[model samples]
Target chain A: MTARPVLSAPPAIERHTISILVDNEPGVLARVIGLFSGRGYNIESLTVAEVDRDATLSRITIVTTGTPMIIEQIKAQLGRLVPVHRVHDLTMEGPFVERETALVKVAGTGEKRVEALRLADVFKARVVDATITSFVFEITGQGEELDRFIGLMAELGLVGVSRTGVVAMSRGPGGI
Target chain B: MSAATSETSLTGADIVLKALRDQGVEVIFGYPGGAVLPIYDALFQQNDIRHILVRHEQAALHAAEGYARSTGKVGVVLVTSGPGATNAVTGLADALMDSIPIVCLSGQVATHLIGNDAFQECDTTGITRPCTKHNYLVKDVNNLARTLHEAFYVAKNGRPGPVVIDIPKDVQFAEGTYRSPADSMPKSYRPQVKPDLNRVEEAIDLLAKAKRPIFYVGGGVINAGPVASQLLTQFVRMTGYPCTTTLMGLGAFPASDRQWLGMLGMHGTYEANLAMHGCDVMVCIGARFDDRVTGKVSEFSPNSVKIHVDIDPSSINKNVRVDVPIVGDAAHVLEDMIRIWKARGKQPDKAALAQWWEQIEFWRARDCLRYEKTSKVIKPQFALERLRAAISGRDDVFITTEVGQHQMWAAQFLPFDRPNHWMTSGGLGTMGYGLPAAIGAQVAHPDALCIDVAGEASILMNIQEMATALQYRLPVKVFILNNQYMGMVRQWQELLHGGRYSESYSEALPDFVKLADAFGGVGLRATEVGQVDDVINEMISIRRPVIVDMCVDPKENCFPMIPGGRAHNEMLLGPDEKVENATPEDGMVLV
Candidate 1:
């Protein structure tokens, strides 16, 4: 028998979550987006909101994936934006917490309805709204947990889903 | 009235003019439109700042860039809304890529009409966000003075680039309190200029032990001003190291120096590229490792330990990674490197360096720039040679070039002894950049000989600038090597694309002499090789705008070319070249 040779797999593409503090000014967001689009870098998820009202500062959370070299370049390029004050790569730094909220709608009339409700209960999802034949469940958890819940609901007469993109923070008392 | 008096209430227009005066702005290249009328009215009321009206908004910005690159100050431009601001985008991108400091004042629709799509309305700030280093939108007249002052500060500071201030039409007419420079210092944008001493020590240590060291310089050294160039020259001389410069960095180091390897890149000298590829330690001073400079990154100087010195931190490791990265001004870091070398009592290994010099001399002895001289048709290289000879003794000549085969030939033949004397579009490679840049240089130094070395195809891109030169009575010379084709494109097509000529030939070229006459300027053409020198002399003696057309050989291609995507040592030499010792296997030295 001929021996089969084993080949090493290519480097895995790791996901990175980064947080940025920037001056809350007009076109600042456009500038950040431009950096990503102009350089052909991918942004998997993004969430931004003003953090400090007095200081007029905003925090932006971005989730992206790339090779190690590409991730470093993205961080470097992001830090160079004029309005940006600081950038923290949470994935590389240390432990971090991430949360996402998803709304799932299921339509059924009999056993499927009971099965949907049972699955929601197991997944710790709350019924936000209901109709005679449909139920809208609001589930909040880590991205993987949400994905698992959505996959289970798909088998139990799942009709639609609306998800808020990933919003992450460091898992400590320190604030960005 | 001195600007110190706070009791006077100034209109926004007056405030803008006053602030420009306080910033030491003597000239502004601009054009007037409906939305910018108020600013133009203010400009008309003052004799302090002279506004030169350009034929197109793009020319205004390029002229401003030329002025800034030559004068080492912030070039200012003013244009109206919509198409006017849109027209300046190319020049803004060019300035950003080349690191030329420019302050562009773009007029906008009234604050209420911003997103309403009013006549001549556009989102100026949104459009310019990517092109400008920084930008601002002034909705209220109360902030106009402060914003304009800050615009200049941001534009001229560390790693200088173009900054735009979009002011609404209402803001221009409204009343505002004018602020001085001392009052509106930036709060968050302080650039780090000092170098870390430990890193400087590390760099010096590497240089001390380096057997084969080469200094790769770039435009940042020129942008750092004359002192930086002086420090670089001192450091190179003290160490007795050979140096090569990028196309934009041509004049930063004296090209006449024997240790100078010619400009390095796709069309650079064979010695410079080989030295860059084979050096044991490479010290890149103020130049980014552009893809053109470092062809095929995996094979680029694989054995060298690289040290990069730049003012901008992001530029470091953006392309090719380096061992020691010093984020500081070129002058500051070079000063520290010199100091550290002196303190260590270190000197380069002379015997080992002699071996390196022997290799470099072997490459240089190939006569990479040599070309055949024909009596019938004037070669472009010969035309530049005659031009160089004509301006040999004069120290006040400034040369600018549009992009193409002529640009490479000019880079090879021209000798610049000082910084700011050679200006061309390097990063963006924008054609039609030379004419307006020459006009700007001429405007800055009225008595100096400003020549725009152009190709037949490239010059036609901004041929309208001839009127601007004539109106200002600026004695700028447009020297065209009329080769009747986009020679660089044609050469590439011939080499890489199996000689499918397709759209590269410039059909129906204008009668350049008649065109010059129509613009009310002197026009001269040399059809034969013998008449080239006389035509250049007559064009120079006219003391007005003149275009000298030297009909050059159309078949000539720029030689010593490292074909795109090839290693530096994989160069294609020209015809009739006899480097008897070089073998095909030796050409793949780094591969």
Candidate 2:
């Protein structure tokens, strides 16, 4: 029997990060996520905050994998929530900057320690904390940039890692 | 900012009333209490805004949900604070999950006493934050116009949902002004409906290339109406796509279409599902990938690449990973798809798709969604069949339902030949939904038949609606499948819940015949199978609010069920599966 193509499209696909402005209410996010989760859409990274101080509005930044066609659709639906005032596809709008903050800790006294600092310095990652046997590095950038930095750290005595999920915004004057 | 409008004096209650009146709100369901006495008193002055008083706060909210779901208008509800505000939670939660539009205004304790837990004080906005689509806490009377304006806008626009506003009792007594309607509501508040032409073009391009294409229309299409219907058929003809709907999406297309897959999911047709599973492309419209439709997520439609069209942006990649996400109202986006397809001068190979249509027909011929076996007592299908015969092809007729074995049976068997004739609480899965919804639908279209197909236990949740129906003199037909048990739950309990029935069976029931008779309407409680046709004929002859307590097979459980916590396609059907004939001869066995 011929196998149906699973993971058929790509060997390595570029992942894009997106953030949406939604109403800060109970079912708003669920309705948004339900739109995804109900349909089997996976959000690689999701973070929501009631950015409008009055708590009347929320911004949900979601990082997902797809072609540009899929990204446009996500923007359109996010604009449809009653509470949703606007939607911004940070990836599509040109020249937008992206960042993800990660707290990394590695414990070692041998050459692994020297290697960790060497890699951290090269990545421009900072040591927020250091002890007799361990060091904690603080790194912030696009998820991929952070991932690459963590990958090199992982082999060199990676111990624990804490990440604040994705938060996104548009590049220019108009805000969603 | 203008003195001409700003200086005008209007109490908070006056502002609330004016805002609602501006929205053309003709009816509101509510209850009175200490915190909201001023608003209710002001309501007495607004002759145009009619109020319906319900026995319970929950009833008011459900009625509002029903109104919103039926009329496609913002459902407005009012209740006092504390217990009153808390009571509306169920209805809010129900609307929230289902994406129905409802604006609930709750009275709060005086603002100064808010945190003290003073009498009738409640943080309605906070308590409802998780359940409502959006909620507001109005601290000043001056903000009343904008708050109510935003509440209505938020509730009715984009992924329609419930919105709540907490009004302090003192605010209602304070003075405010709402002279300009535009001032009350911001211009930026409208939901963007322009379809993504690029995504639409891409979808059409994919459709043109697809050899086996299927379009799954959902309730969102029905909600989008006239425009949605106009665009859907246009797309199907151009794309040579066979379109089907879920229970919620009934009227999105003509059931008579050879392209129609009559509802798809748990109780959905075998061939329709197989066709979806085997399709080269699936265009999912306004429908979330509900578990009932996609049985096992991993096993769902392996061969098909999905294209989800929904107005909510987050839904695009939420559930099933979509190849193409088209965000806009189902109707609006469909319009763009049709336009793009026509502009491209593309023609689908209809003949090439004939084989797939034949496959759907093959399934239709083998096992159409039917349960027809003429017998002794009234068969539920006969009741339905008779209802079908009685329909005069009126485009306005609506059939809403409560969730249960009977509900599945209705969705499976009902012949909704026209659009807008089928309605139900799909996403919320709220039972006891039929009676009030039927009444609400009847209220929306007084000249049309607004009928409800309900189960015995489910109807009891809002049986008082019979009074509402009779009060309105609505000719809404109520079909109560009185098997004296929670049939759907029991079927699962016996089949999967270890056969140790726990509260799944109900033996005590008030005589529904007398109940309807006392309510000043018709009630036909038939037991013998032969009575099915006769009682249905009699009930139709009256054409009024009536209840037909037909004795369905007590053991006549709905089949092709996907046990709870399982995927949609994984049904509990086997060759050994048997339900009682439930005929008088069997006396309806408990097992």
TM-score of chain B of 1: 0.96
Worst 10 residues of 1 chain B by lDDT: B579-588
Task: Return the TM-score for candidate 1, rounded to 2 decimals.
Answer: 0.95
In candidate 2 the C-alpha lDDT for residue B251 amounts to 69
lDDT of each: 0.89, 0.76
Pick out the ten consecutive residues of candidate 2 chain A with the lowest summed lDDT. Answer: A4-13
Q: Compose the digit string of candidate 2's lDDT tens values, residues B114-213.
A: 8898997877876787688677888888888888887887787778889899999989999976655566664345655777687788888888878788
Query: Taking the tens digit of each residue's C-alpha lDDT, what string does model 1 give over A1-176?
Result: 43534656755788999999999988888888888999888899888889999999998988998877778888877876777888999998889989889999999889989999988999999999999899999999998999999998888889999988888888879988
Q: What is the lDDT of residue B494 in candidate 1?
A: 71
Q: How many pairs collide in each candidate, listed in order? A: 0, 27
Report the C-alpha lDDT of model 1 over B373-442, residue by residue, as the tens digit. 7897999999999899999878899899999999999999988878999989988889999999999999
